[model samples]
Target: MKVLVTGGSGFIATWIRHQLLARGHTVLVMDHQDRRGGLLDGEEFFLGDVRDATAVTEAAAHADGIIHLAAVLGTQETISNPRPSAETNIIGSLNVFEAATQYRIPTVYAGVGNHFMRLQGTGCYTITKSAAEDLARMYNAYRDGGQVAIVRPVNAYGPGQSVAAPYGTSKVRKVMPAFTCRALTGTPIEVYGDGTQVSDCVYVEDVARVFVAALEHTACHGAPAQPIEVGPATSCTVLDIARLVADTAAEMTGRAPVDITHLPMRPGEVPNAVVRADTSTLDVLGADHGADSFVPLADGIRNTVRYYAEHWLPGYQLQAA
Candidate 1:
C-alpha cells in the first residue's frame, strides 16, 4: 500500500512515516516545510500545503491511503490567532477530505480528544479541530466514496518533539519538555491551577502505531464515521507528570528534585478534570493494542528527559558559550 502522510515533518508524523515503511508500505510525504531527514530508500516527498486542494490532490495522486496530520495546534496560538488556525485546521482539512473524495481513497483524520468530551473554554484549537472532524464525517457519509476514520489522540509525548520555537526565536512550552528542561536546569516546574487537571499522555511511537492500525482497519469501511480513541488507558494529573519528569531528570543529571510551583492558568485553557481515551472503538476495529501496550509514564519520561539532555540542552549550552 502507498500511504500519503500530510505534515510528514511533524513530531508524530515522523514516527508514523517510519512505521509505514516498516510495514512495507510506500510512503509519500506532503508538507509545506521540509524538516525531514534520513529518509529510507525509495520513499518520496511532495512539497505542498493541505490548504490547497489542487496541491493535495496532485500530491496524493498515487496514494492508496491518506493520513491527514497537518494543522496549527496549541491553545495559545489558536486563541491569539483564530484566522490562521481556522484556515489550516478547517479549510486545510476540507482540502484533504475533498481530495480523498475525489480520488476515492481511504483517509484517517487526526483528531483531538478534547473535542469529543469537552468543547467549552478549550479555545479555537478545539473549535476548529471539532469542525474539521465534523467535515470529515460529512464527507464520509454523503460522498459515497472512500472510507474516513477519525482517531482522537490524547496528549502525545516523546523524543524529537519540538520543545522550543523553530530556530530558537521563542519558547513553545509543552508539558513534558517544559518540565524536563526546568528540572534539568534546577528551576521550578510551573504547575497551573494546583495541577489537578488530569491528562492521558501517550507515547509518540504508540500513537504512530495506532494511526497505522486505524488507517487500515476494515471496520471503518462503509460504516458511519465515528471517532476511535487512541491513547494510554490511565490518566495522570499535571502535577504527577511534572513530578515524574523532575524525578527522572534528577536521577539522570544528579540534580536535586525540582519544586512544582503553582501558577495561574492561562486564558482559554480548560482544566480537564479527567481525560482518558475510550478504546472501545479501537477494539471493534481490532486495533486495541494501545489499550494495554502503552509505555509506562515513568519510563517514557526518562527517555524524554534523556533526549532533551543529549539533544536540546547541549545545543543551548554551546549557543550560550
Candidate 2:
C-alpha cells in the first residue's frame, strides 16, 4: 500500500509514517521544507506546505490513501498567530480534500480532536480546526467520491514531540508536552485553572493505530464517517494527571516528592471537556484492542521523561543531585 502523509514531520504524523512503514507500506510525506526536522534519514519527503495546492496535488499523485495531519495546533498560539492557523488549518485542509478528489484516492483520513469542543481560549485554533472537520464531512457528502474519515484524537502523548513555542504552548494547554516537561524537569507541575478540568490522554502510537484502523475498517470504507473520537476510555482531571506524574517521576528518578500548585484557569476553558467515544464505530474496525493497548499512562510518562533526560535535557545541570 502507498500513502501520503501531510505535515509528516509533526510529532504524531511522523509516528503515523513510522507505523505505516513498519507495516511494509510505502509512505510519501508532504511538509514545509523550512520546518526544523525532516523524517529519519530514509523517509520519502516532499518539501511543501499544505496551502500550496499545486505542490500538494503534485505530492499526492498516485497515492492510494492520504492521511491529512497537517494543521495549526494550540489555542493560545492560534490566538497569537491566527493568520497562519487559518491559512493552514482551513485553507490547507481544502487543498488536501481537493487534491484527494483530483487523485480519486480510495481513502482520505483527516485528523480532528476534542479541541473543537474542549479548547476555549484558543478560539482561533479550535474554530478553524472545527471548520476543517466540517470540510471533511462536506467532502464526504458533496464530493460524492472516496471515503472521508475524521479521526478525533484526544490528548495524544509520547516521545519525539516538539517542545518549542507556539507548538505545544497554551494557557490551558496541559496536554502531553506540558505534563511530560514538568515531570522531567522537577517543576512544580502547576495545574492551570482549578485543576479539575478533565481530559483523556491517548498514546501517540495508539492514535496512529486508530488512523490505520479507521482506514482499514470496511464500515468506514466508502462510507461517511461520524467524527470518531479516539483515546483512552476513561478521562481524568488535571489534578489527577499532575498527581500521577508526580508519583511516576518520583518512582522513575527516586526523587523527593514535590507539590502541585493550582493556578488561575485560562478564560473560556471548559471544566469537564470530556468526549464519549462511540466504540461501536471503532469496534467495526476490529476486535477489542483494549483502551490502554498503546502504553500504560504511567509507563508512557516514564518513557517520555527518559527521552527528555537523554536527549533534549541531557546537558542541563542536575537539580543539586
Candidate 3:
C-alpha cells in the first residue's frame, strides 16, 4: 500500500512513516517543509501546506491511503495565536478530506487525540482539534469512499523528538528540558503545583504502530465506521513522573535529581488527562493486538535524560544553572 502521512516531519509522524516503510508500504510525507531533518529512509518528502487543497490533492493522488497528522498543535502556541490554529487545524483538515475525495482515495485515516478531549486551560488548541475531529467524522458519514478512522493518543514521548517542536510546545519544554538540563548540571528540579496533575504517556512507536494497523484494517472502511482510542492507560501524576525521573537519573548517572518542591503551575494546564482506550473496539476493527504495555515512568525519563545529556547539554539553549 502507498500511504501519505501528513505531518511527516513531526516526532510521532516520523515514527509512523518508519513503521509504514518497515511494513513494506511506500510512504509519502507532506508538511510545510520548515521542520528541520529530512524524511525517513524509503519515504518521499513533499514540501506543501495541508491547508492548500491543490497541494494535498497532488501529493495524495497516487496514494492508496492517508494518515492525516498535520496541524498547528500545542496549547501554549494556540492560546497565544488562535487564528492560525483554526486555519491549520480546522481548515487544514477540510483540505485533506477534500483532497482525498478529489482523488477517490478509499481509506483515509485521521489522527485526533488529547486535544480532542478535555482542554482544561488550553482552550485555543482544544477548540481547533475538537472541531477538526468533528469534521473528520462528518466526512466519514457523508463523503464518498471515506474510510475515516479517528485515533486519539495521549502524551506520546520518545527519541529523536525535539523540545522546540509543536507537540513539545513551550509549556512542555519548560518542564521536560528544565528537569533534564538541571539533572545534567546537578541542580534542584522545580516542582510545579505540588506536581500532582496526572498524565498518560504513551511510547511514540506504539502509537505509530496502531496508526498503521488502523490504515490496514478493512473493517474501518465501512459505514458507521468505528472511532477507536489507543492507550496504555497508565496515569502518572506530575510529581510521580518527577520523582521517578529523579530516582532514575540517580541510578543512571550516580547523581540524585535535585528536589525543589515549590513551583507554580502553568495557566490552562489540566488537572488530570487520563486516556481510556476500548480494546474491544480495536478487536472489532480487526487490528492486530499488541500489549497494552507501557515503559515505566522512571525508565522513560532515564532514556529521555540520557538523550538530552548527549544532544542538548553540550550547546543547546537549555536554561543554565
Candidate 4:
C-alpha cells in the first residue's frame, strides 16, 4: 500500500511512518516543512500543508490511504492564539475529508479525546479537536463520503517528542518532556495544581499501530464507523509521572532526584480530571492493544528519558554554555 501521511514530520507521524515502512508499505510524507531527522532518511517527501485544499487533494490522489495528523496542537498555544490553530485543526480537517471522499480512499483521523476528560478541559484545543472529531463522524455518515476511522489518543509521548521545535513552541510544560528535562538537569519539577489530574499516556508506537489498524478496518467496513480510543492500562497522575521521571533520570544519568513543587493551575486549564483510555476498543478494532502488550509508563519513560538525555541534553548544554 502507498500511504500519504499528512503531518509526516510530527512525533507520532514519525513513528507511524516508521511503522508503515516496517510493514512494507511505501510512505509519502507531506508536511508544511522538513523538521524530520535521520529517522526518515531516504523516504519520499513533499512540502505541503493540509490547509491548502488543492495541495491536500493532490497529495491524496493515487494513495491507498491517509492518516491525517496535521494540526496546530498544544493546549496553551491554541488557547493564546486560537484562530490559526482553529483554522488548521478544523478547516484543515475539512480539506482531508473532502480529498478522501473525492478520491474514495480510506482515512484515519487523530482526535484529542478531550470529550472523555472531565469538563472536556474547555480549552481552545479541546474545542477545536472535539469539533473536528464530530466532523469526522459526520463525514463517515455521509453517503458520498468514505470511511474515516477516528482514534483519540491520550498524551501520546515517546522519543520523537521535542521540548521546542518546528513551531518554536515551548513544549516544556507538557508532562513527559517537562518532568524528564527538569529531572535530567537536577532541577525542581513543577506540578500544576495539587497534582491530582490523571492522564492515560500511550506510547507513540502503539498509537501508530492503532491508526494503521483503523485505516485497514475503515477500508473494509462500510460508512459510519466507530472511533477507537487508545491508552495505557496504567494511568498516571501528575505526581506519579513527576516522581517516576525523577527516579528514572537519577538511575539512568546518575543524577540526584529532583524535588517537586506545586503551583496553581494555569489559566484556561482545568484540574482534577482523569483522561480515560478505552484500550478495549483496540480489541474491538482488532488492533495491537498496547496497554497489555506494548511499553508501559515506566519503560516508556526510560525510553523518553534516554532519548532526551542523548539528543536534547547535548544541545541544551551547548545552548546553556
lDDT of each: 0.81, 0.70, 0.68, 0.80
Worst 10 residues of 1 by lDDT: 164-173
Best by lDDT: 1
Per-residue alpha-carbon lDDT of candidate 2 for residues 231-280, written as tens digits (9 for 90 to 100): 67566777777888777767766786567887775644566565445444
- Give a tens-digit lDDT track for model 1, residues 290-312: 47777888888888999989998
Off by over 4 Å in 1: 36-38, 165-171, 218-225
TM-score of 4: 0.92
- Top TM-score model: 1
Order of the predicted models by lDDT, top scorer first: 1, 4, 2, 3
Among all windows of 10 consecutive residues in model 2, the one with the lowest summed lDDT is 165-174
TM-score of predicted structure 1: 0.94
The candidate 3 region of ten consecutive residues with least summed lDDT is 165-174
Across 196-273, the per-residue lDDT of candidate 4 in tens digits comes to 888768778888887877777777774324678888876778789888889999998787898999998886557787
Show the colliding residue pairs in model 2. Answer: 112-152, 193-265
| Candidate 2: residue 43 lDDT (0-100) | 61
Q: Write the per-residue lDDT of candidate 3 for residues 1-321, one digit (tens) a residue.
A: 888888888778888888898989898888898543576667777789988888888888868888888877666667777798799888888888787766666444444445544445455667877787778778777877665667776666766666643323343363565666565666776776766666656667778887787777743444226666656646666677667666666666677666756676665565554444554555544535443454555566777878876776665544433
Per-model TM values vs. the true structure: 0.94, 0.88, 0.85, 0.92
lDDT of 4: 0.80
